[model samples]
Target: MKLKLYADRMSQPVRAVIIFCKKNGIDFEEIRVDIAKRQNLTPEYAEINPMKQLPAIVDGRFKLFESHAILVYLASSFPGVADHWYPADVFKRSKIHSVLDWHHSNLRRGPTTIVRNTVLAPVLGRPLNPEAAAEGEKFLSASLSKIESVWLKGNGRFLLGGNQPSIADLSLVCDIMQLELLGETERNRLLGPYKEVQQWIENTRNATNPHFDEVHKILMKAKEKLQNPRMKGATNEGGGSDMKRTLHSRI
Candidate 1:
């Protein structure tokens, strides 16, 4: 049997995996597990992935979860993928490892929290969580600052001073893309200070063109919904069906 990928395009991590597979010419069946519909919460899906997250995979009898782990496994297990993605060099690969590890709490948490509170909560029939939003902003600011001062400080086309894109680049950039859901003022507040980070976003896009753009179409479409006044009003409602309806269509 071919590899099975349980994913949803609405998710950034899922998009990273899909983009990687497409970019590397890896053949696998793509399975959509819609989170907005709570499909992943089903009992059957739990058997496939106990954690019940999007972007799980079953390769033969082997099962893997977590986007970073999947990326490394694909890079290492596949025969012809580029070395820069999961480098063979001890130091370079170690740097990639370090970045990925740092990502879960720092880079990943920031946007997830912000988006969930600012946009997702309202759409889910819940009020915006101000405390959580403030916390997310604090962490997000720090993460971006580190990316500018530490990660991108190296003179390379991508992160870790490499000339080619790595999984880390795709992962963090996708996380940063969440800012698109914010209004212009808030988006600028979050992303404007990081000039190098912005440049890196473009470079990663250039490196992973067409595929990157293709995978992110869902997000691009959702960004448009944020501009609509009805959507904003729905979020303000404590538990509005319109908000759920909008999220279901877009998310």
Candidate 2:
């Protein structure tokens, strides 16, 4: 049987996994798990991923959840994957591991909270939380600073001074892609000051391009809908069906 990746592109980790597979020519069926409809919470999904999360995988009978672990598994298990992604060198690999682990608490925290409050909440039929957004900005700025000064300070374009992008680069960059849902001013306000982070993001995007933009098309569409006043009105009416229509089968 072919590999199966249970994913929803709206999810950052899912997008990352999809991009990695596409980039590496890994043949896997992308099983879309629409989170907006709570498809991930279904009993069948729970059996696949006991944690009930998007971006899980079923490689034959082997089932796995958590995006980071999934990425590592794919990089090592799949042939033709480039060494730059995970690297066979023990110390370099350990550094990549450090970044991925830090990503969970630091890098992941900011974008998830901020995007949900500013744009995603309304789409999910939930109310916006400005207070949370405000708090998230602090974490966001600090995390960006860490990435700029520590991660990107190296000689290479990606993390740890490597010319090629690593799994850490893919994961963190995909995490920040959610910020595309925000308006330009808010996005620039958060990312503009950090020149290194901006350039690094661009490098990662360029390196992964076509596929990078392809996977993020859902976010870009959602961003446009969030901007168009008519779309906004439609999204608010009729039990928010327009909003669902915009996101479903795409994000």
Candidate 3:
């Protein structure tokens, strides 16, 4: 049986999986799970992924969640996929593993917290938390400094001192990309000093190509909507459907 991917493109990890599948030409069914609609909370999706996360997979009788694990599984299971993505070299693979493990607590925290508080909370009728967003920016700034000074220090164009991109590169870049949803001032404040990191993001996008653009189109669309004048007074109670429509599906 072909692999089955349950995903919603609005999610960073889900976008990583989508881009990986397209880049490697992996055959899989794309099942859309709209998180804004509470679709992932349904009993049907629970059976596939007990965690009820956005990006889960079914390979025959086996079930798996967690984006990093899924990326590794795809690389190992598919013989046709390029080797550089999840290298067989012991040392290189070890570096990739290290990055993936470090990502959850460090790199992932900033955007998830910032975006949740700045964007989603207001949209969901929750009280806005400026303090939480401020804290997220602090973490985000530190994470970017590490990426610029340490992770990308090597001569290779990509992470892990490799000529080609790896899952580590994809995972972190997607997380950072979430910042694009912020308004210009806030986005610049958070990302402006990370020139190396910004360039790396472009490199990753170029490497992932048409697929990256396609998967990320929703984010761009949402960003545009946020800039609209009419959106100024939009409230969670009154504009819930509009927010749902803007964020729910691929276009």
For each candidate, C-alpha RMSD in Å?
Answer: 3.5, 2.6, 3.2
lDDT of 1 by residue, 9-48 (tens): 8788999999999899899999888887788989989988
Q: In candidate 1, how many Å is residue 249 off?
A: 6.8
lDDT, each prediction:
0.84, 0.87, 0.84
TM-score of each: 0.91, 0.93, 0.92
- Residue 232 lDDT, candidate 3, scale 0-100: 35
- Pairs in steric clash, model 2: 10-251
Q: Report the CA-based lDDT of candidate 3 relative to the real structure.
A: 0.84
The segments of candidate 2 whose C-alpha lies over 4 angstroms from its true place after superposition are: 231-240, 248-251
What tens-digit string does per-residue lDDT give for candidate 3 at 1-251? 99999988889999999999999999999988888678888999999998988799999999999999999999999868898899999988999999888788788989878987886665556788999988988889888898878888988778766678999999999999888888688788788888888889999999999999999988876776665637634754246466645553422
| Model 1: pairs clashing at backbone N, Cα or C within 3 Å | none
Instruction: Name the 10 consecutive residues with the lowest summed lDDT in model 2.
Output: 231-240
TM-score of 2: 0.93
Q: How many clashes does the backbone of model 1 have?
A: 0
The positional error of residue 85 in candidate 1, measured at the CA in angstroms, is: 0.3
